[model samples]
Target: YSGSFLYAIIDWSFGQKCNRHRIRTWNAEQRLICDLLDNYQVRWGRPVRNTSEGVEVRFGLQLIHISDLDEKNQVLITNQWQIYEWEDEALKWNPAHYDNLKDIRLPIKRIWQPDVTLYNYADTRLEEKRDVLAIVYHNGTVLWKPMSIFKSTCQIDIRRFPYDRQNCSMKFGTWTYDQSKVDLKFYRDIEKFDLNSYVKSNEWSIIGNRASRFTEKYDCCPEVYVDLKFFISLERRGGFYNYILILPCVLLSCLTCILFWLPPESPSKLVLGMNIFTSFFVLLLLLYKNMPSNAEHIPRIGAYYCLNMGMIATSTFLCTIVVHIYFRGSGPMPVVFRKVFLEWLATLFFMVPHTNTPEHHESYSLIPPNKAVCGGDKFEKFELLKERFKSLGDKHLRTTNNDPNDENIELTIEHECGQSIEDPLS
Candidate 1:
């Protein structure tokens, strides 16, 4: 009968497992796989805990496990406190014991992460008694899932919220002060129990909801309406801001171009060149100071440095041309040569047309015209002399014709070279 009773008990336990539909439900099967303490014993003990006074205390629970039984009648016991509850009547219970009461699997059913806020002990005058923070879990329903569970302005009561504050004081924490009656510093923990991470996720959410959502209600029906909004913007890449630094580099690069216009022979060209080089170095140092050292590739600003160097190189070339011409010393140039050279240089520089013509050549002669033979007065005098000579010859012929009253025949000297005798008196 005892054996039969034992068999019946086993059958009942199996039946209870089947009723839960372990085979039909995948979740049940998964839960069954981890159900090592189905009838386990619970143990109570004290773990080291820190108090507000910075002192450590021993407090814990002890448990004995009873559920790990197999068909072979092998029973295993575990000391882990799988199922334990606090009895407030046991005055030994500290407020910190509430941390161990979390539902490890409750996160799956929550629409949003669970959060806790505590009631102000000072205001309620229940400093250590009723200052319990209530846990809020967003209910994921068909209608609520589509909406933001934690929005810019969602309902949250400070009376039961838990916050984690680490290095940042600007965020909300469990130890914040409501110094200003009008406003209070809100604290929030990134995770449930971590004290190192703080978040300011709710402040702007409250302000944003006031502007909109005149009549929107949340699950808890909180007194204050808060709409959810993301206060801080996401971090953006700074490649464009890095690109902005190029402007100064370009301006400095342009300064090197001034060296080109400086008179080649003047001392200013070398001085300007050195100054430009110095500026390039200075800019390089500034860029280095602003940027991280040990970089492999050059930044966009470095390209400006390279470009300025190119300008300096071009200036150096121009200086070389100036020096070459100055040292050649071709002596004082003739007017014609100077004109031609200037015209060629201008044509080369300005691309003008050459206008020198042959008549304008320097080697052409300069002389006055010989017009004596072609003069009008000289020809008239010569004709008169000829007429006088002919008249004298005729008078000589008349005297020889024997006119006694006529002047005596004064033969000057008749020298006959080749003249005929008949032509003497006719």
Candidate 2:
């Protein structure tokens, strides 16, 4: 039985070996192709010609993801498309089965690639380099896709803030070569830069994109340098700040109006006014902390904070004056003050007068004589003493009429007896 089993295994092994012959190992084929092209000299520029036409390096960018937009550092993290394609005569292949070999992945060092760099980069660290996938055709056309992460500088304008929109650009150009050696151009005729492939960001929304190419000429060299510019329009997601920062500030600002409704005589009115003012000051500090420290342009929200703080300060000052006036019992009410603040302004603001009650009316009638009724000069000493005595007698009569206690009635009888005796003696 063991001998028969060994014979059957040998037959199956031989049959499977014949079937394995038909299968091709792509890894071994790729190694063979690499060895063939290892000795090829890859030229980094155009074929030498007397004409001005230079090597046209086609460039394009496909935004994949937005890692971050650091407003504080003025930097941005973007995973983007970096496609560099220029005709390479040394890198061409003719696979026996052309239809089966669509593309190949090879170490980028084996072929020539442009030394393109972001001119506005904020970080000095080199981007991570890896093997690039290349598509080889019957002709010598080689399409290369290199992995890249762009950390570029962007000037952020946060004046509008929450509702602000930013137009940032990533500029690509050859590091050392000018237009005479190599020129850059967009990949193809792209009507609108598509963003459907990009990962959506929670903090910002991509609105639109545009691609443009321009050349810069310097006075020192007649050679023109070409740059391919990619413009990305971004609008801030305002829902967060609208509810967290703006709405609270607006509500606190509106609360200052309620101070007017509080009775001026209550100590709580002053306490509440102070508390509101303190809150306004704290909100202003928070606004300053969140804003960039640029003196050239102030944000509109900052202006609103300033205005609100000014209003709060003004209200506080007026509240102090109102409390003083409400409790002031020693000094005479100035005639001008009585006419303006007590009559016209009070009525206009719907503030009910305290002098309407019977007790208050009696006290109001005892107001000190106006200086205008004294012939526009200081009163004579004799007349001043006479007016003082008359005021004292009026106050005594009002007190006796309001109180009917036994002490007040006895005092009144004693005053009558003394007056009768003094009258006969005089």
Give the number of the best model, judged by lDDT. 2
What TM-score would you give candidate 2 relative to the actual structure? Answer: 0.69
List residue ranges in candidate 1 displaced over 4 A. Answer: 1-254, 331-350, 353-426
Best by TM-score: 2
lDDT of each: 0.29, 0.61
> What's model 2's lDDT at 373?
17
| Cα lDDT for residue 34, candidate 1 | 27
Give the alpha carbon lDDT tens digit for every residue of 119-160 in model 1: 211123211211122222122111111100111111121111
Give the CA lDDT, 0 to 100, for residue 422 in model 2. Answer: 20
lDDT score, candidate 1, position 25: 55
Each candidate's TM vs. the true structure?
0.27, 0.69
